[model samples]
Target: MGMEIPDPISIESVGTWSDEVDVVVIGAGMAGVSAALEARASGASVLVLDSGGRLTCTSAMAGGHFYLGGGTEVQQATGWDDSPEAMADYLGLMSPECDPAKISAYAEDGVEHFRWLESLGFEFNRSFYPEKAVVQPGVEGLSFTGNEKCLDVAEVVKPTPRGHKVPVPGDTGGAGLVVGLALDKLDALGVEVRWETGATAMVVDGDQVVGVTWKNYDHTGAIRARSVIVAAGGFVLNRAMLEEHAPDLLAVESNGMALGNTHDDGLGIRMGQSVGGVADYLDKVFVTGPFYPPGEALRGIVVNKLGKRFVNEDSYHSRTSAFVFEQPDREGYLILDSATMVQPSYRFQPLVDGWDTIEEMEQGLGIPAGALAETMAAYDEAAARGEDPEFHKAPEYLVPLDQGPWGAYDLTPGKCFYAGFSCGGLRVTVDGQLLRADGSVVRGVYAAGACASNIAVDGKGYASGIQLGEASYFGRRAGRRATAEVAQR
Candidate 1:
């Protein structure tokens, strides 16, 4: 069975309203918090609702990478000269269908947004992560969280690292951003925050979304508002929705975990849909099968079932994994020699099989007898010459993998430690206004975060910090526009 969109309750159906506010923001994640704060600052009465009892939304669970560019203070301090045009150009190339207006807006406004986050105590140290990594180690503030440095991307735009992480070590910075920073400010500003309260349906009057109905353990009611913002999240945890929208995820469902918590069930998206909002790119997902962390593993070569190199191993992990997922039967193998092999820094992918020679590895992994040997010989020859004509891997990472005791990591979808979340949701403009198929607006309805198909629409085009960056940035935009409407009235 597929996901069923709920029918919205008409304003006449709710004889009386339990409460009222100028703006009602749903889901207290990064986006929702940003929205509520901005709306309140604009002198609009704001109410925030969370489906869960606590702040464990996907943003809070993230690794705290805010993909800010355009020469943020930290980026300038670290000596990376970046411009809004360069950032927009790189992002535009990331996905052909990504809205250019959103990319331009995000890049142009990123430096100011960085200052805003710093004002909220989201501290960042003035330093750069020096190695290739999925996440920067220790407390450094900037890292390369995307394929900007890859040969293809660097050719189009001057590559610059923009993943601005919180100074907190490890993945706990996300919790710090949500609980330690945004939550306290919300309390100080007296935004009405209701937890354990889930939004059930939108309340419509004619063609406008006037409010939303809600429910908890004991009661059900409606909150009448002039504007409503749904920052709920994506539908990765809902199996039915995944089966209907992005079914490729199910192949690795048992072996991997969803990036989001149980509350990411797509009700917020469905609620928006019921009121004539439309969605696109629903089949996209951000699946990552990381094979490096012994960064030396970049010297290795990844081959498909046909025993040919499919991608540059030095590309971003998600980019590599996205290519792996498209191979025959979603199967791939990483060939590494003894000199390049080490205990992995992360547990995502482990050495599944090893052998003393290339021929043995081919036979062990069920590839045709001579395919692995020929591929290895060609790759080694190119490495020895400090060149990669086929994939254009950087010369620095081009090491000859001729050492003894060759091994392979099972790059098959289920065998690798693949983890991801859905990237598709309701289609919205750069200001976070929901729009229908024919470019008509759903009045009084706005959205941000994972629930809105804003910047992060393509899995293959993903960068680490895009979700949190766009969520908070666009969330503030939604709040401002929603309240501006109230001021007009």
Candidate 2:
């Protein structure tokens, strides 16, 4: 035997049918699959491994909205005037530490990324829905899913809709059908996809990553490959990783659940970190609040248990969700009225207690005699005057809550349906090369999607489709970069 390997790989002999391919991909989610497809198309023998025993993942569970703009075909079809400069300006405001080069690259080439996804047989509709929504409301493919148009915000970029919802409908939404189509394309391309195979550690050769040691069901062996691509997702599910790196997010009440699928346990990140890869943004988690679907909920106000308005009610869903977690006791309620139509979310069904008047509702909620009443009076007065002096809420959603039949939905951590996903992962360059603490690139290895945190790490700044868009976009870039590696070749 060459050298005694440890737990994940126990081999009696080397090269015992346990060798590998040109590109060995760990985690077969959107990023991994995208990387695999690109590598295979580049004439490299590719192998994809999944911790999940199947093709499904957190990507599959998503609404399938891919945030794309920058004069894309869909934007052209909608006759929406948008450019790369506008995209860059709008997205740069999301996070202070967001990579400047990466944002520029995304704004300039996201249209091509959208087209690449189309080449994978994924399709987006040409129509645009001119409304604010978490996902597309109608069959239209485009909508505003961020703070792009919110009032009192940075007006440097003229607003345009960017959330491109994929054409997958029914119970599963866009993820089910689009991933299925990509699977068909990968199959046609002869990409080897192995399910139930989990990479446990990196097989490093000096400063370069040679391969990885993995466990496939009962079989444990090392796959010696030319290069490795780790798209195995972030550490949201790994309690130890979260506690060690991002304790604040871990300590936050997440309604007792991590937003991602079970396989998102930081295995890929850990494997990369073992070989000098640096992880970042572990404190950033995208939290989705139970707000707006009927559009009427936008007229409502959210308050802490102390009955104080915490954020602009009209902010994007993710932004609203993050602020709710910052409230006292990590809980609150959505205060609304008869004009504010209440629509229930499939995920969040907080107790909706309706009362005849503000005073009666305050009595029912036990919000210290005059606190909630005064808050409502101020909000109603501002709405009637067609302005929100307190929170700068948009005038269109500023309809007064004066009408009786007031309602309050629980926005508590354990009670409401607040969902969060760990957005922190390995730090990478604009080209998807995993970086070290010393800013050195981990040669022969690449990472993308939630496994990397150079993009969209600001939980409060997330736009819908950003994760999916980044996965497919940078995954392909990483894939192309890996295939061009002369050492690997």
State which candidate has the highest TM-score: 1
**Candidate whose lDDT is highest:** 1
Q: Give the number of colliding residue pairs in candidate 2.
A: 0
Question: How many steric clashes between backbone atoms does each model show?
Answer: 0, 0
Q: Write the per-residue lDDT of candidate 1 for residues 260-348, one digit (tens) a residue.
A: 87889998888889988988888998888787776887888999988889998888888888899899888898888998876556666
Candidate 2, 154-252: lDDT as tens digits: 345677888888886532458656666777888888886788888877776678887887787789988877778989887677777677766545644
lDDT of 2: 0.78
TM-score of each: 0.98, 0.92
Candidate 1: which pairs clash?
A: none
